[model samples]
Target: MIEVENLTLRFGGLVAVNDLSLVVRPRTIHALIGPNGAGKSTTFNCISRLYRPTSGRIRVLGRDVSGLRPQDLAPLGVARTFQNLELFGGLSVLENVLIGAHVHCGGGLRERLAARPPAVIGHVEHLLERVGLAEFRHAQASALDFGRQKMLELARALAIRPRILLLDEPAAGLRNREIGALDRLLNELVERDGLTVLLVEHVMQLVMAISHRVTVMNFGARIAEGTPAEVRRDPLVVEAYLGQEAAHA
Candidate 1:
């Protein structure tokens, strides 16, 4: 559903992404894995139109989006969650999700909340339940535990009803149980809802267990691309990111 070709982004002398190219097929989960400074997030920024690339093209849903503004992406069915939590601390979980829904719901925040349109309300409630935060919907975002907060962010992203979801490290700060829950939720999204996902995550088990394809990167460029099993056994991927122990595991 997304294609990036010969993409490069330079910050003066620092080349954050260099000639990177990859494809995310429709209705599947793709993982982008690499070391800390491997430019995964930088590539995401370019795809999301948060950063303009120095060269090359980005196509989403078959249209070249290289010149579109960030706001332009949502209308084109794109949504994402950040590596760090971006929830509004003071807003209730419901309110935060409502903000995301505003793109589709079309009303002032107070109007939407007070009227609680059946279509919008039902969608938001379903997302809350999907993320296991239905009970916390009325609570302040800051009041939830970290794992719940992550789930809340996921709900907000889904509020847009995006065709393609770009998740930046969704498994970064969670207990094993929480990670397991996330794994199941992601699979369900792709299988049941037909949502295409491109996630950048460091959790090897999560990536290997769910991803249809894996692309390995280092120093801002792709070093390997294949299925999860194929990537795990690549010698360069083992040395550069996964390590020998992880490769063996």
Candidate 2:
């Protein structure tokens, strides 16, 4: 569903992503794993149009999106969560998600709310429920705990009804139980909802347990790409990212 061909990005003298290439198949969980400074987030920024590549191409659902603006992505069935929380701290949980739904609901927010109240409100409520935030809908986003805040961001992304989801470190700062919940939710999204996922994560347990394919990166380039088991056995992946103990585990 997503393809990166010979993608390169340079920040002055430093090269963040160096001719990296990978493909994420439809309705599957494809993971991008690497150590710090591996350019995983930079590659995401390029795909999401937050950063223009120095060279190469990015295609989403068969269209070249290299030149598209970040706002343009949501309308084309794309939505992403940041590696860090990007929540509107001052907004209510429900209100934050409603903003994401604006892509689907055209016209001014007041007008849409007045005309198609049921559809818009129902959809946002459903998304909140899906992410276990139904009870917190009226709460301020900044008032929620860390894990709940993460889930709220996921809900907001889902409000766009994206076919492809790019999640950067969704497992970071989450408790084991919350991680388990995230695992189930992600599987449900792909299996039942037919969503495609491109995940960049450092949480090995979550990545290994859930991903259908894994691409390992080091020094801003791909070193290995395979099934989780195959990647675990790859010498380059072990040496660069997973290490000997992790490879054995």
Off by over 4 Å in 1: 107-115
lDDT of each: 0.93, 0.93
lDDT of 2 by residue, 25-109 (tens): 9999999999999999999999999999999999999999967899999999999999999998998898888877887677776
Error of 1 at 137 (Å): 0.9
Q: What would the per-residue lDDT of candidate 1 be over residues 1-249, giving only the tens digit for each residue?
A: 999999999999999999999999999999999999999999999999999999999999999997799988998889999999999989999988988887777667776556667788889999999999999999999999999999999999999999999999999989999999999999999999999999999999899999999999999999999999899999999999898899889
- Candidate 2 regions with alpha-carbon error over 4 angstroms: 107-116
How many pairs collide in each candidate, listed in order? 0, 0
- Work out the TM-score per prediction: 0.97, 0.96
Report how far residue 176 has shifted in candidate 1, in Å. Answer: 0.5
